[model samples]
Target: MLYSYAGHILVIDLTTGNIEKQELNEDYARQYVGGRGLGARYLYDLLKPGIDALSPDNILIMMTGPFTATGIYACQKYEWVTKSPLTNIYLCNNTGGSFGVRLKESGYDGIIIKGASNTPKYILIDGDNVDLQDASSVWGKKVSETQRAIYEMTKADTIVCTGSSADLPNPVKFAGVYDGHRCSGRGGLGAVFGSKNLKAIAVMKPNKKIEPKIYNPSGLKDELSELIKDIKKNEVTGEQLPKFGSIIWMDTTAQFGILPTRNYQDILTYEDIEGKIDTTGYGKKVVKSKELKAINCLDCPILSGHVVIPDHGEWAGKPTKGPEFETSWALGANLGIIDFGHIISANKECNEYGIDTISTGVAIGFAMECRQKGLINDDILEWGNSESVIKMIGKIANREGWLGDTLADGVRSASEKIGNGSNSFALHVKGLEVPAYDPRGVWGMALTYATSIRGACHLKSWTVAAENSKDYIPVSTEKKAKLVKDIQDLRSVMDSLIVCFFAGRAINKDWIVRLVNVVTDFDWTPEKLDEIGARIYDLERMISVREGITSKDDLLPHRIMEEPLNNGQWKGKKITKENMEIMLREYYKLRNWDENGIPKRSV
Candidate 1:
């Protein structure tokens, strides 16, 4: 009997309308653990090399870890692994919601989706019964509407669906799949759903409420009690995040002089954007709605999710999910929009449209910069134009007009199409748009973005906090490679365990090993867990390598490498090509990869 897992994987081939259930491999489970690691293993075996990411040959794997639905705090995440339509490389996107828990209750550890459906369809999983049903009724609806329609029809506990953006004739490349307001919102996985003609996946709570068999329930409980104490003691996890939400980082990043502003043209401090878009300003302008209380993921202690109503603006009194730090920077500062209400409204639009806020904001910001440089002739796409930013969101979602179609493909493709030396400033690595952080301000982020397997992502290895610590200089490159590699490996373990990254603050290595031992009955040490993480990371790199990733592709955007910051304490600082190469070389050496960034060991 599998202890903490559902012990089965459901495979669906849309082309043939075939569904099969395979027993979980015990050896594989122990080696890869679960979530991103398990999903990546399945994807690497099932997917064909050199296939277009949106093609039927590209497989989509969603897996849950042993920690999922096992009464583990903040273990609400599940991984979505596949080739990215945006970056044309390995993509693993995870989300925190009730969906993973519900799916686990439905008696499956994961579901592997492949092949294109003949027509629009949605997957319905209710306990032991699973089927593909017609989705024509909800085909072109927005995310919330589709979710509502499906929920009413099937009475499922959770529904994850793409919005109308994914139903377009040509889907937006940065389209996202949403579970309620929370989303797997990067790497264009939703576009792959469009290609497969998949509308939504609805999972009903099992009639019997299936529970995983815990090996040492009492031991687990005692450890969790101690962990709860640690979580309460940690400042980041306890007070700041719960009270202010992630927007609390707004002031911190600004103070560090790493806050991205106006498409990376400059870095701004809280004083610069105070009372307009700063954290204090957000709190003053956007009040939590009386209708909804603060929200948190399943079994999470921290209530970081906020639902707010703007006090003033066209969107006044309208309740929406409050913009987090990344969303605020991307849609507010990066696009030069100061009004907190406008940022909230734009965030709402992105959620409804099922588009990535980071990529969407950066793409629009890229266009704004292009227009300023005469590459784009549009007058409306000017810096600080909130109205234009909101308008462009609609255009990008629907792939409407020339600018819409170009930008919908993402900044890299948009820059390529609007060529006139615009590619020099195109802010992407491996075709994925850079996130909110300015790499020039923190030198470690330069290497982080360049080496990330999924593309330019901050979550892969968030070096900002470590680099900002007193022991390390944020601007220096010394030992950054080791720092990044260690964090990346640690994150892999955390991600595979499928725990919330925020929860990781309290759940350190000793806690992780103890939890794994009690839950799965595995006698795992910190070193063994570390080895598994490295193995998983190496396996993902191998998958990307098979898809043509190499040292040349492990690169930062030209702007990040060449453009020096003009404002802030780190003024005149830039990550030059030589600096990047040195980091890459050291990183490659640490990973036991060749000079070309390929893994030395054969699969």
Candidate 2:
């Protein structure tokens, strides 16, 4: 059999103390690609609905995409997924760092971990050799501290760990880490690690090859060489994101009235900030991660890094990494705190703890709203009280109190506890908490958030780009469904190719195909690629539907429908139930899904 991948997939059953390696099957490789899409395929094949998320039966997967370790922009992320204790659906959390490259070098495209371990131990991979280390000393260490200690022991090796004190017995209090900087950052992947008595995964593979070309670019080598050259020659990455890192969009979202403020009850526009959120040469505020510093991936050169916030308060001098678009929207404006340091530090803590920062921020925001309304108490939560917030983080990782315990369930499940009116604003698509954007104003986002298999993830398909495209009006619904659907198909294709979501749109589909063609001579036509994307998307939907979701589960929160942007560029805009339903039906029809949003089997 021909091996297209330089690496293999390693499956370790901690419970059984068995380890095996499987070569990448070309059929599966071409179909699912890597990262989220591959994760779904793996889960679809292995997962049985309603299994306990924290059980030894749950298989935790650490996966990377095809472009990992190749020179591809924003292609640095790796996926960590399981039956999410948060969403209860297929959940894949990605972290961008050097881990993907390391994972590839360790001779695995992905790692599937099953069976629970009885002792606090870590899985260490130094090239092909694997060891189960005693992590008793490393247990309860923060991700940063653990990284330092473990790396010190391993002599500066790249490490991903979840021994942080944040891991509790339940999802409410679970956090894990990818490295010191990036985080899987969601869905209690860390807690699962803790439950398994698994402390960390240390990967120290330095020299490894992960790319195997299935299509050749030779045919288009001369023809499309100019485009590749153009991309290389330009400082597009440097010019757009330098200094601010992902936080560059902070003030911009505020200007557009999309910044979620006060728990989605209001949009904190540039007017509300009143120059407090001013854009500087660095960004609108203190840049936590700087794009000027590095556009690091395995081999890509689009410098993106945390802008190093000079900290204060409990997190004084704490250099937080990102409030990138997601963190910015969820933590910064969503909770009505313009304190950049606080925002950065919170995200930093989430990263260190190995929890999804978006959900943490949103969960806290919901808690704050509940507190203010007397639905809950300051004893439970206090707005802008960083101490309480920090405590809540601890409580969540520890599942300390009732509210914290409830919140560990995430916004969708947690909201159910509020009993009345709270469910209306629970703000989630598929149980994953919504990021900062309020879809009420951005019509395309309504669909994006609603249909996202992982609940409000913008990565699955970025229709907002088309809606905000220079070619179309931002708010119009006409042609939106077609544009969104097309993008979704294209996105699925790029995902299999394992490039960054940003790159999926930054470069054209034809260019990507050509790039792949150069590496492998496969005749990957755009139409065929789209079909592949559609099929994967359909399969993911099937996974969701099989797990018991229906058209009813595909609806947005009522607050987004009831609320309008009270000020700024977007005003008097609110998506009605009828309007949203129509758009959804249209979207389903375009995808060959039934009225209930189920994909036709023949499709």
Candidate 3:
């Protein structure tokens, strides 16, 4: 009998309105663990390569790990896995809100949704009773409005939904949850929902917590206490993160010259904009003005989320969840915008419109660059133009006009269509827009961006912290590969446990293994758990390969690899082709991939 698992995998076919429950295979759980690992394994087994990402054949899997609802710190998150319409490759987007815990407490390990519906619909899951109800009334509403509608109708506290943006003719690549703040906001998964005619999912509040039958409850309790203590003692998790949130990253990344600025043109020159763009400035201008409220996910001690009420200027009374590190970099330095209020307003707009801020910001930055170069004759798009940025956010989400349609597809596709030399400056890898970190400053991020299966992503393996550490040798590619691989494996484990990445910094490997063992009654060593991470990574890589990713696809954006930093700490530095090739060789060797980055058939 399973101890930590729900012992069931619920499958829903929206086309036929049919729901089926299948037993959770214990052997499968033993091999892949749960959450990301299990989700990837299932995708590999069930999904055919080259299926249209937005088609009915493409499936959406919502999964939770063993630690979810087990009182494990920051385990309230859940993953949404599907073929990405944005990248046309495997994608996994996770969120922390009330959804994962409520889902697990509803007596199901995860949800596998398949097939498109003929009409607009929403899934209402109340314990064993599941219904696909018509969503015609809520169909074209914004994210927050739709969520509120669901809550009023079902009295459900957790709702994951798409906005009218997803229903665009070209469709956007983001979606939101609950308060229109927390999001599964990448890879066009929201567009996939629109394609399937799925508007929202409502999981009713569970009457009682689904208590897992743990083998050693007392021992588990003791270990959890120790883990909490460690988390509290850590400077990042206990203090700065809770107080400043991820906003603190802006200062560190900027100091290191890794922050993407002016559309990847230069990392420095942002000193002038610091007062209006940096975290310190935001705290002084906004946080102190009776407007900042630190928020957190359920069971998270860090309180990494914040809601800022701006009551002083253009955004005189706007409350928004975040202009978090990535979003801030995208909108602030990348586009050269310095208005803090404008950034906050844009954040709220993205949430309501249901678009990924990173992608939206990056895409707009690309358009601004295109305008500067005279590639596009548009007066509205220019560097640091906050008004234009705000206008474009709505246009892109709705796919309103020629510019909207061009950018709604993101930087990659937009560049392809625009084609003046715009593609040269289009900063994307594997068709997904690059995030905040400028690779020329921190080299591990070079490898991280290149090899990420989900495209240019930082979350897949965030190694900037280590690369910036005192012990790290900045120029050496020798240890870079090993560092990236280790972090990826470690993050894989954390994702399965479904804990916040920040929490994992304090939660050690030994404690993680202990928690899993007590919960599942499985004798898993640290090495064994690490192996699962490796296995999951390889599986995702293989899936991407099946969808046609190769060493050729593992590349940094042109500007990042070729352009030297015009100024800052990394003034003369650039990631040359030779440097990147050397690192890729080492990374491929470590992963047991051939020179072409293809996994060998013999394993």
Instruction: Please give the distance, in angstroms, between residue 140's alpha carbon in candidate 2 and its true position after superposition.
Output: 2.1
Winner on lDDT (1 vs 3): 1
Candidate with more favorable, higher lDDT: 2 or 3: 3
Superposed by TM-score, candidate 2 places the C-alpha of residue 322 at a distance from the truth, in angstroms, of 4.2
Off by over 4 Å in 3: 174-180, 285-295, 311-316, 601-603
Tens digit of per-residue lDDT, candidate 3, span 1-603: 877887788899988889998888787777777888888888888888999888899988888888888888877788878899889999987677777878888888899999999999999988887889889989889987898888899997578898889866557754433323577787788999988999999988777766656767888788788888888889888887777678778877877777767788877444755766666777754443222332357757677777676543345575656568788778767888766777777877787788888899999999888888888888978888888888898888888788887888889889989997788899998888899888888899999999987899999898888887886866557589989888888788778767787777787788788888888777889999888888888888888889988999999888888888887778888898999999999888888889989887421
- lDDT tens readout by residue for model 1, 396-473: 999989999999999999988999988888899999999888888788888989989899999989999889998788
Please tell me which model should have the higher TM-score, number 2 or number 3. Answer: 3
lDDT of 2 by residue, 1-603 (tens): 222344478889898788888876666776676776777788788878878777888878878776665544556567776776666666666666777777775678888888888877888887767777888888877777788888877753667787454445453433555665666666667777877888888887555544444343345346345654544554445454544455556655666567767788767766666555434422544543444243244445555554456364455565455456677556666776666666666766666666667887888888888788778766736655666666776666556678877887787777787876788778777777777666766688888778876667777766654566687666666776777778777776666556665444346787777665555445577877777788878887887787788888887877777667675577778888877777888898999999988898642
- Candidate 2, overall lDDT? 0.69
Q: lDDT per model, in order? A: 0.87, 0.69, 0.81
Better of 1 and 2 by TM-score: 1
TM-score of 3: 0.96
- Model 1, poorest ten-residue lDDT window? 286-295
TM-score of each: 0.98, 0.90, 0.96
